[model samples]
Target: MNVHETEVRARALGLLRSGSKNADVARELSVPVGTIGYWKHLDRAKRGECPGRHDPKCPRCDGRGLDEPAYSYLLGLYLGDGHISHYSAHRVPNLMVTCGESWPGLLDECELAMRTVFPDNSVCQVRRTGCRNVKVYSKHLECLFPQHGPGKKHERAIVLEPWQQAIVDAHPWEFIRGLIHSDGCRITNWTTRLVAGERKRYEYPRYFFSNKSDDIRKLFTDALDSVGVEWTTLARGSDPFNISVARKASVALMDTHVGPKH
Candidate 1:
């Protein structure tokens, strides 16, 4: 390659490392996207960063299009109540989502989302005292869920990656449903009101999502905002750790999409 070509390749690699996709890098450099991929492949080879084996199931590793809606839902579940752990003996990773036995429908939905994301992988449920652990094993769990790391999710920063944010943007309701399924509830509170002369019972429905992580709460509320749902943050003592949606229109929207966890 000529000097100009070499400079363009270097800039493309920098952009890719900075989270720019191949098409974006191509547009910025005024080069074909295929050429950008070629340069990236060559750069990885030059740096000896190629993996010994590649899993085609991993969208990031193999450049396959992900099932964004399913992924968005799964991502919400993950951020809410899911965890990833590696087997010490074999290094294989497992992604587990804790689902309450009370909501068997939610448990089934969680398993379905996992299967949609990893069609070839096996999803199973392990019974716990009051919940079932819906889990799937995959070598590329880390690739799918970059948030997997040491410590609890609330203990660490829970910012979503750019790609993940895109998925959430495209399917905010599904994402909200997943989060609500995992850590939220829909309840009705009633009170007695005097209408003219007679006392009447009035009931109002609300949605509440509770998570200890401030970042996760922000993400949930952000999604709510995107879908024109009004939410308020509730504090426990001095710590703000809950989001509530009680506005009539917002509640109707939630009922249309999420409803109660069957």
Candidate 2:
């Protein structure tokens, strides 16, 4: 390995010793998480440690890349709640190049980025198509012929919207809030009632019921605060409520607590 490669490996080992998840370390280091496993194996060998017999021609070592890198990159965008349709060869090539790394580090970095960007949940692969070679069309061709011609054999290209990109760019809390609001679920009158007067506090459902909600709420508040939004907490019964608004901020603070209404 070159000097840079050695440095990266050393940093990775340090991260592993620090109890960082292998997948997280991989992503941060832009390597495959499985590479960590290989490193461990190598380490054991160097120390005359014996691990059980393992496959010699593992796909990763053989240079046959795994889907982890691509998965990790997408995970950074989705945070475990978005859809991925693999029909765009042009787009996929760029993504692969950008995210290309060994599985261990790639997976680790992807997960870490997800946690930092969206701590509420891990990125989930909702859908995936078969692994097939896709043709990357030139930009000029794409612009000139936006639609697929009759002779095209490949699947249709997938288009991601600006809102989707926004979710990818925002922190986890912001992403979750956007998802929730985008669902178009009507706010409950009861939840809104808490914000009407001094009863600003509200409790979420059971811990299990709210799952990722609390984390998301905290994240949103942090984002709000960064923008100079003044906020205060109120107590209503046992529940806690947050009241915040931006200074010279146009976005209205929703006074309503989010909950299911019967």
Candidate 3:
């Protein structure tokens, strides 16, 4: 682990031992509660209390690329709305991705993605105030999600290494699906038109993604461009901007590849 991770893990553990709730600790640290929970599991495993999903001799952690389908899909989610925390107190990485509680389907998809990425680990979901949290414990996760760092994604650079770029180039659609499912959404846009002599409601579907980081926005659009998915920039007078694909064929293509998150 690094110095920042070491400091955060220490703070989390200390705060927890001092009668602080996991949520409170997370709030104080600007991290997800699942992150503190991962530290808790690590504290147990270190004392021979819990058998964690950790193996020092695992080949996946032998400094090789983990270019897999699950990782590709997860990359999109991470860039969109996921957060990966590397704690020195834990033996592996803790990844937390949440969606609104109202969208159980999205929550289910996030859980499924986590399970697929870490089949040997148990994915846990915690009910928060307005969102559902999905946490996964796996050592190999850090390899695939090297973007794990401090502050918000928009506040710093979000560049991918050469290895990660190669994986994304190989699975562009999966990346797009994850991004759309997380930060973007599919919706129907209706407009009144003259079908007969009077008027008719024409409904069309579209996919949109909004992010503050220019790098993230570029990454998302580049992935779409690679897949021949045409999208346009939507005007928004804010820091984080939105881009969308509303053409008929493009929507169908996204539907076939990504579909609705639920």
TM-score of each: 0.77, 0.21, 0.74
lDDT of 1 at 38: 53
Q: Which model, 1 or 3, shows the larger lDDT?
A: 1
Candidate 2 deviation (Cα RMSD): 18.2
Worst lDDT run of 10 residues, candidate 2, spans 131-140
lDDT of 3 by residue, 1-262 (tens): 8999999999898887787877798898997655676676666577664424455333246654243676788788878888987667656567888778888877767777776766666466766789877777766566667777889998999999897788899999888888887899888888998866999888888988988888999999999899888999886765548989998888889999999867
Error of 1 at 52 (Å): 14
Q: What's the lDDT for all of these models?
A: 0.84, 0.35, 0.78
lDDT of 2 by residue, 125-236 (tens): 1111321111111122222112223332123333334433343344333433332322212222224344546566443321111112343345445544553445454345
Task: Tell me the alpha-carbon RMSD of every candidate.
Answer: 16.7, 18.2, 9.3
Number of residue pairs clashing in candidate 1, backbone atoms closer than 3 angstroms, sequence gap of 3 or more or interchain: 0
Off by over 4 Å in 2: 1-212, 241-262
Give the number of the best model, judged by lDDT.
1
Better of 2 and 3 by lDDT: 3
Q: Deviation in angstroms for 92 in model 3?
A: 5.0
